[model samples]
Target: MGPKVIAFFLPRPPNYPMPFVDVGDDILLDILALCDVYTVIAVSAIDKRLHALTQTKQLWLSLIQDSTFRHVLELRPPNNLELQLHSTRELVDLIKRAVIGPPPWWPGGPSSSRTPSYTIAFNTGLEIIHDYRLLPGARYMALRGASAVGKDLVMYEVWTGRCVWGIAKRTLTRFAIDVVPGGTTARVLLALPTAYVGGGYHLYVEEVDFITGTSSEVFRLGFATRLKSLIAIVGEFLLYSLPSSDAEEKQVLVNWRKSTYVVLNYGTETNSSAILIPGYIVASHPDTSPPYQQLFTVTELDAFAPHWQPLTTISLSGQLFPSTIPITTQERLEYKGRPLGEFMRTHVRLSITPSAVYRGASTVMVYVNEFPKPRPTPTLTAQMGAFFRGRRQPEESARAALLTYWLKPPGQACGLRLVSAQLATPSFNTSPLTPPRAVLEHSGSSFTVSYYQ
Candidate 1:
């Protein structure tokens, strides 16, 4: 009559209180092996069972064999391989710190300090300096100066205060310099003047070894006008811009290794700027993929424009790592001025120049300048009027300030938070001779920062 219906029973999913811990050690080790160094370290802290499991030599050996950990080991190179092999835990911890970076610090907290560790004064008698760069790895500082006879380039060690390299004054007027990222084998990209041809000046990119101080010509480009600026150099790509009759200028990207070039032209009215941080090339454009991504370029737009408000992220996108974390911008403006009615009264010019974004760390040191405009320029006419009225010449408004932001992890709802803000003092003011600026050089463990007063 009725079809024989066999009651099929389904195996219920295991709801064990500690299902993960109940897994066999081999299975657990396999799962932990797939986790990142940070995750393994965090799991190890949870309980004694997992701690013992994570501390096994087998697990650490697996991490040491990972591609990323191996790369860091190669770059920083351990002192002794035997010691590393003997102490896999120590090696894993070291690599973990290198990848995960320093611990997060609270904004406006006790850890934030504006004082410079130390200051170095430049020789005053030198010619007017046009541009300067702090080499990655924080071992060297390079300065390019303009003189009547020729331009002078000098390099110095930050710790020893020694002039490691120097270019005896030469007649190259236009110059720009950039340091290759990572390793002791830092290559300096120097743009030097060559022979005049085709009714314009010829320029060549010279690859200089920072260690040996040997240089060779890479390639040459002919420019009708002067090379305005060397925006950045990432991998083989060198991005620079030139002065043009039209305000809309095209930024040229040249691959020194491949001997090829591409021109990126932003529409008129977009005052674009770009910089190469540790991992990515950040640019200013309205069409940026994620709205939360940081905008490095300075823009002039109405209050309604999306670019009007400062973003809460220190966004970064590159070959290996691509992610965005929210940043705290309000705390940074605490000393500058109030945010509410102040915006309507005076135009606030905000510029974000990131010096270094350390790999494996959430900390970013950037120079932020939020000042009201029109930045009063002291003109002869104004000076005469002030003199006639017996009033002190309007004190030049302090426009440049240095800020450091600490990026928080996801799901915390905390974005980029300002940890420190210090106004550029009068001693740090820019002049015809020494410009008020700071350059970040990567030291092995920390940064050797140089500020020009």
Candidate 2:
């Protein structure tokens, strides 16, 4: 007791928080993986060691597998090889760009606050890009182009711009692609054109697995004078066009999986164009009188043949253009001495984001160009014909409107947006009649309108 009393009283040192930098690297990585990209970036600034630790490849790779964020980005699984080629910082930056909009400092950022948009270009390994298409949900893109070696049909991950699957051939080919429901893979129908020994061209349709990269000949059509337009691959069916022996264009609906085909013949309608939607094939043709645009639908794939069912016919004369704009200009334009109204034409361009899950329903964008009635004079007729054929630019008087129909969406009404009447011709460099297109991006949440000249 005496010894204890003699000892001077000493105050215990106050407890303080441990420095974050003292945490083990493994624990730090685990913590960062649970955080959003911004949190990780903020933590990195606390200490030099943390700055390096936050850049760990393992940390960013784990973040990419986060399911909630993946859905938001509409991300397709990145190729394992391509995934490793990018640095941790670049991967983090990509997540940031996808989650939040592009950096405000970007030179050409989003065009509008409501609709964020930016452009990124990656090498496609083609000398000339013939055509490119984004599969439904915009997770993947298909491209066909000419290369110095020959031709290339390729598919890429839209976000990373990495070629996931591709083939180079010595012959020209056409491709139609569709996602396989799961995000990791796709089904591609390739049309190969070859010279038949007898006379006309032979078309061999091959089905390819995007994951395995193996292909098999699904079917072949002989005596095709021209390569059919491979419009789309909807489920197990393929919608395309073939020229019949009678010199008439036949729209074909083929169940490539079943090895059976049906002709989408709207009897005597030579001007019809068809596009495949989820549960329907939408066909549009002009009506005989007063020149109305008619839309027809063919039901989903069935065990037997499907026939076209009339949907509705709409007149653009009074709806799109006002009564003041004459159907036939005052220049006394006549077709065979008859008023040119009889020669009026409606050109339809159809686009669809085929998956219904992303948008609550499938959305079909029907873009119609209502051309002025043509005069029978060889000069005027040829000029008007050239525009429709995509050989010349659309005239100032041509009218266009975008009609969006949400198939089977509960309680939602369809809407139409009128595009500018002074349609600026998209420069294809090779073709003048290519229409302005609205591309659905990032799982139907946003879209960008693009024009090519």
Candidate 3:
């Protein structure tokens, strides 16, 4: 309704800073990107225009692309998280917290040694759960039921407990998930047993795309119908174990992408536990007296031939075994007022599980739990007494320790270096009668342990 107002605009006040708001969004974003994360955050709070510019997803993504806080990202990976779900302030806060390191109450921090900082309950909707894996980045978890029918794999977001993807109608004999870089996709290798035309069952290596839920058969091999096996995938390489004809375990390494595999000679250790990383396969036989771990590297024999061989072996004698375990004696009295004593014998038994590996940092974490071997089946009265006590009896000792070993970097040594060791008094109060299963999550710098009944 008013006449042309181009000549009627208000005059600029003295010292009024207008240039800051006059820049194009592209130029402003480029300048903000050049600044450190904190500086950008500080600039965002200066004015509305600057704040809007900093809020762009492109700006935050650019910063994440150049961030060097890899270990921090591993602890809270961006898996299943969409940028639109978070605001600029939340994104900036994440980077700031990562730069400052995890807080004391963080599950991976020192406080976890005493008690868990927090807990999350995941209901599988099944009565029996066979096994579950907390996927890398701690964003999602995969679970398999103990039943052989109905359902196979169920994956859900860790925070919201939302079912993102699932597979039904097939039994997942053994499976491993490798979340590829950028958190855009995950690769799952499934070992499915199928009945052949004649009689015997053959296992198929089926690869599933975590994002789309599409599956394709990678390879097929004959496996002993009665024998148990384990499989792990890292990138394109797959490490699996099978029982040899001599009853010894055969460790096989396969690059499923190239469709080539080589059988590794692990030298007749039937009690070994093997785990796969990006470029290495670590196998440990903790049942032995002292316990030892072997590291095998995937090496290429030629352009067309790739094989894995023994790289180094590390002795875990003094580390995994505890030195001073408390010894206690139990005394039982005779009937009436007479004094009669009974002796109870106990010895420490050590067991270790290879928990996680920081691929780029060359670090590995192991969970060790040492407890006294139980005596013969106790009388009903004694069992009830133990139950009423609400904790482990004085005669029994339980200790849980975390051991970290740093693998030798390239072109240096051939042995693993002991980085840091943490020992804690384990409390199994959650499931006193039944031993609680421990779930360990490591973030390169620190690790967290969760117990499941």
Candidate 4:
């Protein structure tokens, strides 16, 4: 200690290689910023020379910035998975085995048809396109749900209000009104008909382009008929089951093909249950080059699939409303304690705004390949109610009231709160701490407002 000799120092190790080149941590960091993420990950895995680069937390942090890289990592590793599942060679086969347990479809594919029949679902509507040859000549039924999926093609439903006819390269006519869950209530748009019988007829509802649209309906089959006789079409239909309070949610035996579509009822769904419907499911194939078809679903290990054979790999995440709304995932893709099938419901109410009142007949139509076939005559009217939480009632009504609502889409950005308040007499003691009685939460497409006076 007294000599102050640096005994631990290796006297410059005689000639240990040359001098230590000082790339400097700062210089190395700058160089790291220059290289692409791919380069960084590659270089960081080598021996110490390059491996040291990864030790820099900033480099790894920067790598996370690329969305594409992050997404791949998210899907590949799938970290934070609380529910673990068995890995199989073919995940699709596993999914099929899990959901559609029994052999629901012929492994060979759909049987050859004569007139050509397509499978329809109640929740996700159906779409059938007939060439001009079958347009005015063929007799068929149209069915659908709320909206049409898959565009690059225009599918039209009937006009929602009164009857109207026009010349669309020919004489065209559309049936009025739409088919919704709440009996006679209609949406802002109608499910257009792809088939016209007895004469050349058509309904103009919406236009589109690249057919890539898909939405959910309530039924197992949602078909659309443009024919004025909606009652006749639906009344004669038995493929879909009517709503019932006593029924149980189960997979109904429908298609005879290897590809089977399933259904679930909202009125019958239980807690922790989901209704998983695959996306891009269709009965008809367009007669074109290299048919573009997709029907797949992915279920999680903890997924509530009672069966796990035929209907395993079904994915409803990308379907129209399923995409926007937080519907179920077959495997609970986010691990939020549910599979897709256990998530969706039949009857959906969407809250909307017309920039005006929902005076005239408006539609919130749902469809499969297209809009759901509309009910010819609508009898149910919209049911609306309002309440407020902080609103103070007056002798006749209230003094000052406040509304607390959990808004949904279409009218989500709108701050319009249903309130009624005047003033209480000076004698009556009212505190500002009294919360309003109004509570509104979004259910389906409509806002459900509930409160006590």
Flag regions of model 4 displaced more than 4 Å: 1-247, 250-259, 263-268, 275-453
The C-alpha lDDT values of all candidates are: 0.46, 0.51, 0.48, 0.26
Q: Estimate each model's TM-score.
A: 0.44, 0.48, 0.47, 0.19
Which lDDT tens digits does candidate 2 get at residues 196-285? 553434445565565565666665553343434777886667777655455244666666565555555432334556676555555554
Please give the ranking of all candidate structures by TM-score, highest first, separated by commas: 2, 3, 1, 4
| TM-score head-to-head 2 vs 3, winner | 2
Candidate 3 residue-wise lDDT, 1-453, digit = tens: 888656677889998877755778899889877665656768879989888787887787667544233322444433325644666667666556544433433433443333332233433235366667677655566777622224567665554545556676354567777766445366676666555532333445555565565667665553423225656777777676655666345566666666555555433444334566654555433221212222212222232142323322211221111111110111111113322111121111222222221224345554434445466787889889889988655565544544456654233334355566565344421212212233445332222444221
- Best candidate, lDDT-wise? 2
- lDDT of residue 380 for candidate 4: 35
**Candidate 2 runs further than 4 Å off:** 1-134, 143-151, 158-163, 196-226, 244-248, 267-271, 288-293, 296-298, 303-344, 354-360, 374-399, 409-453
What is the C-alpha lDDT profile of model 4 across 125-241, one tens digit per residue? 433432111110011112222233332122232111111111122122222222221122221122233454533222222211112323322222234321222111111111122
Give residue 149's error in model 1 in angstroms.
15
- Lowest summed lDDT window (length 10), candidate 3: 321-330
Candidate 3: lDDT over CA atoms? Answer: 0.48
Root-mean-square deviation of each candidate, in angstroms? 13.0, 17.5, 17.4, 25.4
Clash pairs, candidate 3, are none
